[model samples]
Target: MRTVFVQIGEIMTRTPVLVAGAGLSGLSTAVFLGMHGTPALVVERHESTSTHPKARGQQTHTMEALRLVGLEDAFVAASPKSRGFALRIAASASGPVFHEILHDTFVPMGHLSPAASADASQEAAERLLLGRARELGADVRFSTELVSFEQDSDGVTAVLRDLRTGEESTVEAEYLVGADGHRSPVRTALGIGTHGSGSIAHNVLWGIRADLGHVVGEEQVLYYLQNPELSGGTGVLVSTDDADRFVVGVGFDPDTQHLDDFTPERAVEQIRIATGVPDLEVEILDRAPVETGMYVADRFSSGRAHLVGDAAHTMPPQGGMGGNTAILDGFYLAWKLAAVLRGEAGPGLLDSHDAERRPVGEWIATNQYRNAMVRTGARYDGPPPVEDPATLFFGYRHNGAVVSEPGDEHELLEDPNAPTGRPGSRAPHVVLDSPDGPLSTIELFGREFVVLTGSEEWERAAKSVAADLGVRLTAHRIGDGLTGPWAEPYGVSDDGAVLVRPDRFIAWRSPGPGPATDLERALRSVLAR
Candidate 1:
């Protein structure tokens, strides 16, 4: 329910969704909303999309979300191709390579993922998302800032100010999203507090163009070079587009060593220290000071306003998961918002975002702290843990109205390497052939709730319930000449059915043929009709 109001001094506008920020999280949410036929107005205080190359690692899970909206190939295309498999960590830039901190052998990430992973710069991803969102009819406004907002039972009324013209206007939206980054003003305006190891560190990120082929001997994506002469003493070299183009990030303490200590000229000098080259010519492309930390908001939503990305959770740059997880936040919230706005689901559906993603965010933050420990060479109390990339990306679950109750903590996250179709887990990726072509079980989801069953009677019952409920439900009967017995892994009998939500997460499953009343009650309970 929304009640529109126009204040005397503010220009009035309206959009179903108002996204406050144009970063990866905000833009992706807008794009996914547009894909679902919901128009959103995206506001960014910046004049244009960011060119910074922070958080360049896009995990397969992120790519899966991008694939759902048809941006996976484009995202992968813009990534840097690895010239070699080993990531070299050395005492100095010019010394013998000491150890391979990371390797290419473990990087065949696509096999473990539904799609594949990519090393695309954050800026490149933003550019592509901006174009796609616009194409899908989102009204994206740069140089516009969401100054203030108020929400009641019906909707949100936000005051947006154009930074360039100093013009302020009011917009009424059914829902509002805050993806505005770690220093989220929207989260603050809503009186949301965050808790965690807040101040992890700080850094000055320099995107530089320099010739380091002699030092590396081959192309590599990451280099952790240690040199005592440089500011912060050690820094990570991340690959950019060209072999010569790279981003160097040096973390410093604001209290003792200042960020102002690292100037453009000083940055180049430090780059030479890391590369072991006394005098290397380096061109500075972009520079930005980022305050790195770990924190998660106490709440993800207040009234009709919700938070995603850095606004909802913040973590260090250890695993390069900050942006990737942000993309996931957008993905989880977008479909739920779309369903509610399209009148296919009730507002209770929105509650799942917090129940699901907030836990994931906390887990990610805790793991990121482990990464920081590795960087410091501090011995863990027990033993150092390996950062399992695939496990971190896909092994998470939420139990609530949208999903069947999970078994236990161990069962909650099934083996990432061998994911079974467990209730409350992401639906297993099954390649089934369709009349049009081969389709993934994932491809059959997102636009509507789907029923996967081999029994004709189950199919008939699903269709009957769908029609009666007036829900966008698709029942895919197995063994229609294009499939086989795929029920063993799902714990489903031949006549059983699995109900998947639009986001490809298992909602409910019947072990065998159930009475029509039972199926209807399950559907009604999930849909909140």
Candidate 2:
């Protein structure tokens, strides 16, 4: 609970959600909130969307989240079509391979999900999200900064400043979100401390435009350069969204070398050495010094203020889960905030964000830190095991009051291949046929509570519960819009029903015909009514 305050003669704009930092997490929060009919005011100090291609890989779960909003096709189309896959360690792009990390035959998981993973630049994704947010009535202001904020018991009162004009205004919001990247001032103001391997190493990121199609071939490759001439004796080279564009990462020791040491001439020479081409023409697009580290905030939420993306967790770039995790943080938080703000849930529902996501952040960051250590050839006493991509992407399990029948001995990750529609697990994706065509069960969520069952009695019970609870609940008989065998996979009998949250996570499941108050009790508990 947070209180709101205002001063006389001060201009104030009221929004249910006020988001700080217009990076992937902030934009995602705004877009998802808009999808739920809760328009948020997003403030960014930058003049526009990111120009640099920050994170390039969007995992399968991230694609699924984007699919809920119908942006999956656009994202897939924007990504480069690779002819092959490779992740190798070599002296240079054209040099002999020192080691082969992963060389597997890529297979599509169309049977598992309606959405497939793709690699799209962050800039392109942000552009599409910005368009969708605007269409959904989100107020996104560029060149604006969240100066400061305070929260008490009812809401949050924030001061925003226009960086261009130096004009300051007040914003009163029911909830505040900080998606303001790793060096978040919002996190600092909240006195939230982070814990993990603080700084793994320091490196320079160089965004360059170079035609390496002939040298690197059509394979989607990650080349770890081990040329001794380069600083730190190692670097990374990977292709970008543009055919002629690429990005490079060169490690440097701060104790000996500095940013000033990497001059324009030195950059060209280093790029040539890393490519094994003495006469290659290269155009430097951007350069920045980056700190590779693992960080997870001690808490995800404090009062009405919450943290997402880098503000909540930061990790090394080895796992490609940084941006994907950020998108999920927004997805998970937005729905909870929307429910509470819409008066469909009590304030206690907000507490679930920290419980559900903080563990996830900690796990991901720790794994990524170990991966980075192993990849960079740093010495570590513990052996780092590679996690299955499916498990990392889809195997989350939640617990607490929101989920019915949350058993003891809760495991954080489950095997997605073994579908378990238990309470607090991701709803199993089932392909069901409709008059429109065949669609996955994943398509039936994202807006309101959904009941999936084959029995007419279960459907009627759901309707009755909706009427009693006064919540937006929709019931779909298995044979109606969706035709499929869902009971066994859903861990329910033919007459049983499964209740799914707006995010497509299972809240409760009835094994067979239950009491008339079963569904009502579940909804009441889930919503903290």
TM-score of 2: 0.95
Tens digits of lDDT, candidate 1, 1-529: 2333445655787888999999989998998888787888899999888777776767777887888778889987887666644566665646666666676623665444457777777889899899999999889999999999999978888999989989899899999999998999999999999999788656677878888877665655566656567566666676766778778776667788766687667887777776667788988887777776789999998889899999999887776788888887877788789878877678887876777778878888878877766664435664454477767776777565554545544343556567667667777766767787766666667667888888898888888988887777888888875585467766789789888877777888888898766677776777665
Residue 98 in candidate 1 has what lDDT?
67
Worst 10 residues of 1 by lDDT: 1-10
Error of 2 at 18 (Å): 0.4
After superposing candidate 2 on the true structure, give the runs of residues whose Cα lies further than 4 Å from its correct spot. Answer: 1-9, 103-107, 404-406
| Predicted structure 2: lDDT | 0.84
Tens-digit lDDT track of model 2 for 1-529? 2222335476778888999988899999998998888889899999999887777767777888888777889888877787756777888888888888766424456656777877787878888888888887789999999899999887888999999999999998999999999988899999999999899888788999988888888877778777778888888888776778888878888889989899999999988888888898999998998888888999899999999999999998776788898888889888899889888898888888888899888988888888777766778867584467777777877765356564536678888788888887888889888998887888887778999999899899989988887889999998766788888989998899999998888988898988759888889888888
- Candidate 1 regions exceeding 4 Å error are 1-10, 84-88, 93-98, 109-114, 263-265, 378-386, 403-412, 433-439
* Residue 357 lDDT (model 2): 90
Task: Say which candidate scores most in lDDT.
Answer: 2
How accurate locally is residue 271 in candidate 1, as Cα lDDT from 0 to 100? 73
**CA shift of 92, model 2, Å:** 1.6
